[model samples]
Target: MPVLEIETIRGVQLMTMNRPKSLNSLNEELSSALIRAFHMASEDDEVRVVVLNGAGKGFCSGLDLTTVDSIGEQSSRFQALDEYGWVGRLALAISECDKPVIAAMNGIAAGAGLSLALAADMRYMAASARVTTGYIRRALSPDAGMSYFLPRLVGPNRAAKWLFTGQDIAAFEAEQAGLVDEVYADGEFMPHVLRIAYDIADQAPLALTYTKRLLHASFDTDLRSQLRQEFTSIKACFATEDVAEGMQAFSEKRKPIYRGR
Candidate 1:
């Protein structure tokens, strides 16, 4: 069986980590499979939204220590964290994906698993789901973009509190802290999240992509620069057929069917 299971529902692409016996842990094979999956999803015009989840009880338990790089050689160790490595590529593939990506946490996520979720555009958690920065427990610091994305998601103070003490954050607490977009009962979680993904899919694809791009760029740019980007983006949108369809739909008081053009 594949390490990652791929499925499609409407315009939403579901990528489920399948190492269930180990709680969907990220070994080299699983990590590489995820990188390829995200890239394929991004290139497929049919995929408007992506939902990442895990099989069985736990979402992902981070690295499979038995299959990772050894710590013996300091100079070349932790190659998974290098720019071209599997873990790094997977995180970038999610964050920089043209379409919006949502992390569907069906259960617990720790270490690099939580980092992957934090890299996504949005995250939806089951009531029973939990997440933690587990590196500290292993006598290590954050990896796989955890250090970068966490502070941006929850602010420096909150990020510090969690990172400093490797505590498992419950769904309720995560929602309250803005670490997750929404939380729902475990049994109905996927259905609820799918509805949201479909609603977003209903919008013009180009508009959604541009919106995500602008949002990501906003963090490192000035107000003037962001305004310029917005101006350029809207101008570009005006040239697309979807914008015309949207306008016509508004006039007719009906939903628009965008064709991505």
Candidate 2:
């Protein structure tokens, strides 16, 4: 079976991590598959949003230990520089995709698995899901953007506490700490996620993409710069056919049908 399974629902593209026997762990093949999937979504004009989830028991259990051991055996000099290699670049690609990407965490996620989820613009978790930074347990520092992301997601102090101790956080705690956007029962995860994706896809694609881009830039920009970017994007949006439809709909007091132009 394919390591990554992709399907389209409306304008949303869903990518499922398939290695159920390993709890959907990240292997080189899976990583490469994910990279291709995200690139396709970004380039496909018909795709407006992307949702990532895992199959079977958990979202992801982390990187496959067998792969790690093999890499270690192959290299004469141990190096941290090769930590992500292609996989790390894939993570960045997912993060910067023009379309919004959402993570649907159905169960526990650790190590690189957790980092992959964190790369998404939004995350929805099952009530039973959990997440942890896995480096401390393996006698190493965090990888897969964990070092840069955690402190930003949770405050630096909390990030330090969790990273140093390798603390696993429950879904409820993650929501409270601002790591997740929402939580649904395990049985309702897919339904709620699909509802959200469809709703987002129904909007103008250019507007949604610009909003996503602006949100990402806001993470690193000051208020003045972000405001300028917002003005620029809004002006750009005004030039799209969808914006004209939106205005007409407002005048008619009816729902706007956006064509994503």
TM-score of each: 0.94, 0.92
Give stretches of model 2 more than 4 Å off: 70-84
lDDT for residue 182 in candidate 1, whole number 0-100: 93
lDDT (CA) per prediction:
0.91, 0.88
**What is the TM-score of candidate 2?**
0.92
Alpha carbon RMSD to native, model 2? 2.6
| Lowest-sum lDDT 10-residue window in model 2 | 71-80
In the order shown, the candidates' Cα RMSDs to the true structure are: 2.3, 2.6
